[model samples]
Target: MKIKKKKRTSLLYQTNVEYGDWCLNHIENCAHGCKYPCYAMMMAKRFGRIKSYDEWINPILVENSLEILDKEIPKYKDKINFVHLCFTTDPFMYKYPEVVELTLKIIKKLNENDIKITALTKGVLPEILKNFSPENEYGVTLVSLTEHFKTNYEPYAAPFEERLKSLKHLHEAGFRTWVSIEPYPTPNIDPENKIDALLDIVSFADKIVFGRMNYNPEINNFKDARRFFEECSQKVIKFCEQNNKEHHIKFGTRYFDNKNTQTLFNKK
Candidate 1:
């Protein structure tokens, strides 16, 4: 039997996360394509196929996606509470104006049916998000503030300051904003100063998700990275408690023991 291609909206199963029930990718590739040895790229490299992530993962418009959505929504509408945009690529990439417009249109249709829409991006442009509604949640991915680290690891993403500025703009526009601090490499460095800076920018955010580096032998691993990550998590949680901010630390099986971290956070 030949498998039918899904129409306008691609069908995503689900994850344990609270954000969305369905995930859709408007594009196939990521422009930034971090050099710090991402797991996704590692798999692609081992296959000896694509030279760079952009060759395979950068944004590709799915011509049939929108029409597919119009048909699928009626059948699975009850199963979806939220629709997440572009899990594999940034929806706000500089070259995706047409894709962005179609995404906004699809989101509007979803909203009419009571499903929420959320997006996570590196935030290269603030104007791209002008149409997002208050019910839509926006997440900005941030790894480091130091320019040298950012240049080496994330050459294609916008500068740290510009991304923060985009976050601030979304917050001021009345949209729910969040931050994803994943792949925290230089974890031992004191985040007290950095946390202070982030807090100033994301004061309007409803919550934050803290994550550490994924297990990858090829990537440069700092000796004290885990210790620093925990220290930063502690500081962030304490700061959030004092200032009434909500935060969660995500520790997958590869990085740290989940039971120990859970116990540590559970203590009063």
Candidate 2:
């Protein structure tokens, strides 16, 4: 899909999150190419914004993104509840060197204008994230610790160890750091005990956002996924509680509301 370069009247795009007000997607289509197979890619294809795997592999940098943002940020600056960076794309995607530069520029500009920003990525953590500001919140998605899961899924992204190190770096730098295990590749990455492997890095994170894998049933090994994920969520809850970490159990992964248990039986 081509980059939507046309200048917009607004860059503070509104969306839902845990008290999140607006978001910005300076780039579209992540170069990470998570083949779990990426749900974002699936949605983009469903809507005809992206039509092929080859196109998904090649990311597009939104043209005049910062210029458009400059025009829009002032309008929503007062009402902003910490704008999130690039939900449709990785704000720190390093596969495209230009995106790395753009991300840094955007963050720096927003910080200068006192517009709080939060971002999560499987990509690099540039030097700019070390700021002492209370407004900057940075996060990384460390879904699994195994190299196999990463190579098979997020092939073009940074190595798992590097990603963890970046998260730790930001956390220790006194920046508000968070982690996402969303679409937490549970039984998909480890058919044996996915939650244990998933929570191995919980201590490094200040906040954790996790949810069940959706729309990738073909790759999972859970016999009764809904029940399994509910159990997994329980484990995550316990782990986070014991460690005194803030955690969010995203929708569809909640046991109380899971509605796919018609033939549910544990085969694990």
CA RMSD of each candidate after superposition: 6.2, 6.7
lDDT to native, each model: 0.62, 0.72
Model 1 worst lDDT run, 10 consecutive residues:
259-268
Q: Residue by residue across 148-235, what tens digits does model 2's lDDT show?
A: 7777777888887777788788877777677788767656465443567657765777777777777776535556777777877888
Best by TM-score: 2
Residue 92 C-alpha lDDT in model 2: 81
Best by lDDT: 2
- Deviating ranges (above 4 Å) for candidate 1: 1-9, 16-20, 43-51, 125-131, 187-196, 216-221, 253-268
Clashing pairs in 2: none
Candidate 1 lDDT (Cα, 0 to 1) = 0.62
| Model 2 Cα shift for residue 263 (angstroms) | 34
